[model samples]
Target: MSNKIKKKKMKKRWKISALVLVIIAIIGVVGYVGLQNFLKWKAPELSGEPKVGEWYRITPEGTKSANGKDWHSLIKVGKENKVIVYFFGGGLAVDEYTAARPLNDDGGFYADYADVDFGVKFGIASNNKENPFKDWTILAIPYSTGDLHAGSGEYEYTDLNGNKQILYHNGYINYTSFMKEAMKYIPNPDTLLIAGFSAGGFGTSLLADDIITQYFPQVNNVTVAVDSSLLLTDTWHDVAENMWQTPKEISDRLVSDNITLDSLTSLSKKYGNKIKILFGSSLRDEALSTYQSYFRNGILSTTNENGDIYEKDLAKMVADLQENIPNVGIYIWNEIEKNKDGKNLTPHTILPSPNFYGKKYSEDKSIADWIVNAVNGNINSYGLDLLDK
Candidate 1:
């Protein structure tokens, strides 16, 4: 073939290939966006009797997320008589500035809505064979209201654009309503595990008492596990009292800046050996450290200094809890991960991570094993050496 003709033919083929690639890219983008939108607006429907081992998304009436979106929870019917009421974490909105901006992701100020699909295949809520709570019925509460699942009042704030906005801050209401619905399905569980991660970890510490006293009064075998929940701020009492408008019982315990520490301490004193308390966290949780930085420096920073600060605070908090509540079980793991900027960051919560089943600090005990043992009244600490490091 002539050289010019050969070149022209090659050019034409290349153009065709480029055109096809462009078309595929467009379709992929459209499909991805369409899927996201569908998931966001999909209405939940659960028909007939609750089936065992199947997850059902339930949207109880009067449940609203921070952004006024419809809130929902996930429940799975299990063959066992044990029940796990788990609260998922997002972030917190402590003030008007934070309330107006709900980032709906990790390290954000808060989440605007619950992710219905979250926890379907993770940790205690998963169907994984290695999961300790695999057969236990689950009531998974997704965080969205930005009040650590403890607020019941509406908060008004001004947006960055200067527009007035109202945040639901209705976490207390949402969980209570969902619990009522959950009781209808799994009414008489012999063993009840109340647990939460990050923001929800704070919730577990704050609300476990109410849950036990109000709902499962007859179940004596109860355990509470809090994962990676920490926020050092002096305004916690004020925020709990005025902004979140938490129950007096919960707010009154906020005599100190660390809500999780305060609540857990009070709970230990009140419940004593009646309820097993397990607390776990990374030595330098990136998410919690960033939040701590925000509270300390008025900016969200994930610096090595901030991480050191978090570690010091965590060590002190652990020591205080141990001194105040002698039997409290502690689990501290330091799993090195990376942040978006490629900086070294310790992972935040383990209960919802896939590693929950296999990750271990002790040679014979995985976090899951430790949790199972604790739930069975064999409370012991794991990963405590990480704190020394």
Candidate 2:
């Protein structure tokens, strides 16, 4: 063969190889795009509301006295005609938190609380150890920024990726302003049981009195259960008074704080006999030491110079109520800690995930049984005598 002829053949072979490589690359890109689209299309169906679930989102604007914030609430109505309204705590600035909330829309993280369901069944067992409600309706609200609620000012907005969203500024006020507006939908106050874990629990205590007096005067007739809450004590009661002070008007003398212990005590009084305050505590809770120092001293000292809190002094409160009030049911579960270092170190933080620390209270039947007792009105037997002393 001639030299030129051989060179031509080699060039043709190289060109063919290059063309084949280009074709393979195009096919690979097409397959990757299709796979991503398929996953995106299927993700929504999985995240949609469960068969027995109902979801609601509420935004309460700030009022005149209190600057409002936005918050998300999820109220899951159980099988039995009973309802549990869950208040979730998240975000530093109100707008940024609400903007990334999971209840309204499904992102990478949603329904990460003990209340939500897993594939096989609900992750958290009921007090009865059986799912009581036929259905559950969840309400989510953004309680931090006024933009979400009726409070004054605005909050900075951040994107889904945690990038600086829109910079917004809003006046700071606690969640009472938001709760007051939420009372409009008490959902047949008679059958409602208000409960929250962590920050939601704090909000429950803050709103318990109002819900009792203003919305559910029959709170004595119903159950108010809280899990992993009642830790941080607030200072002011209503936007108006502080029960710890002799004059009640002394709230004005204090600096601006969101919640007060006096408010919780006074709120506890309205439906004294009817309201059932149940606490779920973990002895080794990593945040316990920090919260005890920060919130206990911070708020309790202002009003209760003696320095009292539900965790440390629960026995005394139980006794005092037993001595005076009738039919005041209280249950306390001293949850055993599973991990020493705290597996869910950041569970309580605004960032949500299933990585919880302490022990798993949901699967424990004892915790479920206690809840069932409260539901059936049999909780009066839980060492009422202990509270008496």
lDDT tens digits, residue span 63-105, model 1 = 9998888999888889999999898887788876567556722
Error of 2 at 107 (Å): 21
The C-alpha stretches of model 2 lying farther than 4 A from their native spots are 1-52, 58-80, 90-129, 134-190, 216-220, 230-264, 295-327, 335-365, 380-389
Write down the worst ten-residue block by lDDT for model 1: 11-20
Best prediction by lDDT: 1
What is the C-alpha lDDT profile of model 2 across 72-172, one tens digit per residue?
23333344444554444321112233333322232211121221221112213122133433243333332333121212333334455767543222212
Pairs that collide, model 1: none
Whole-model Cα lDDT of every candidate shown, in order = 0.79, 0.35
For model 2, what is the alpha-carbon lDDT of residue 374? Answer: 72
